[model samples]
Target: MIHETERTAAAYAAVLTTCGDRASAKALARALVERQLAACVQMLPIDSIYTWDGKIEEAAEILLICKIKRADYEAVEKAIRALHAYATPEIVMLPIAQGFGPYLAWIDSVTR
Candidate 1:
């Protein structure tokens, strides 16, 4: 289990964001990995249902799943905001409860 105070550099985070289409999603993914903010970014097609501008809405979106060391989340969020086309992109981070030792180690190695 990861405690809140000790999560800065030692923990892992899975960041979530959505893009309107494939082109934008791919660009964001490349940027995150190239900057060493995330070890991997997986894109998946998803249908989103939400309320915006006081109205109900539904649309197709590309979900970006980014795996990164907890320490690098700030930089990652900044990078995403810079490149994202949406005015308010959904940038959320979730803690990784547990992962394979080798994979977790790889995440730490690739990110600062």
Candidate 2:
């Protein structure tokens, strides 16, 4: 379990974003990490099937796994929204329970 202090100052959130293609994913990932809103962004290619406008849709999507502090969520969200191609992108956060001390420290250092 994560302590209160850790929760207040630090957190890990995976921001799910899907781009039209690989190029867009790369561009978004680079921007996020460069801005420091995210310590890291992992881009993954995935096939997705969903419903839109009462129709079934299937497309190739890219997932952006963003590692960031709790304090940075707002900034991260703003940046992603600005860069996203979709009018309303999927942006969600999940709290990290615990992490390795050294790596967590590194995450804190880089993000701060």
Candidate 3:
């Protein structure tokens, strides 16, 4: 059965961000996990096309999906800004409405 909660304190989140290169992505992922700001960070290579400086651009990037506690979103965002090398980085959070109970509990155990 799918696990769901109405705790107002909705427990978990998946934060997304993209890094220009593999090295930076790995570094950021490591930092978040090491600091316990994220329970886990999954990285994937992707091609992106976006507009910047009034022009269209395309580039290869590494996408980092960070699993964290909902309450720590601000702190996680702050750390990303501090460590990220982008003039304006992509930082987005998706609420995890329902998840396996054990996995959600694990996220809680690892993150503050």
lDDT of each: 0.90, 0.80, 0.90
Give the TM-score comparing model 2 with the true structure, all chains together.
Answer: 0.87
Which whole-number lDDT from 0 to 100 does residue 20 have in model 1? Answer: 99
Off by over 4 Å in 1: 1-10
Tens digit per residue, CA lDDT, model 2, 2-100 = 654465434665567778888988999899888877778888889889898899999999988888887788888899899989887888887676676
lDDT of 3: 0.90
Give stretches of model 3 more than 4 Å off. Answer: 1-4, 7-9
Displacement of the residue 1 alpha carbon in candidate 1, Å: 16
**Ranking, TM-score, top scorer first:** 3, 1, 2
Q: How well does each candidate superpose onto the true structure, as a TM-score?
A: 0.89, 0.87, 0.92
- Model 2 has a clash total of 0
Who is ahead in lDDT, 1 or 3? 3
TM-score of model 3 vs. true structure: 0.92
* RMSD list, candidates in order: 3.5, 2.8, 2.6
Question: Best by TM-score, which number?
Answer: 3
- The CA lDDT at 49 in model 3 is 99
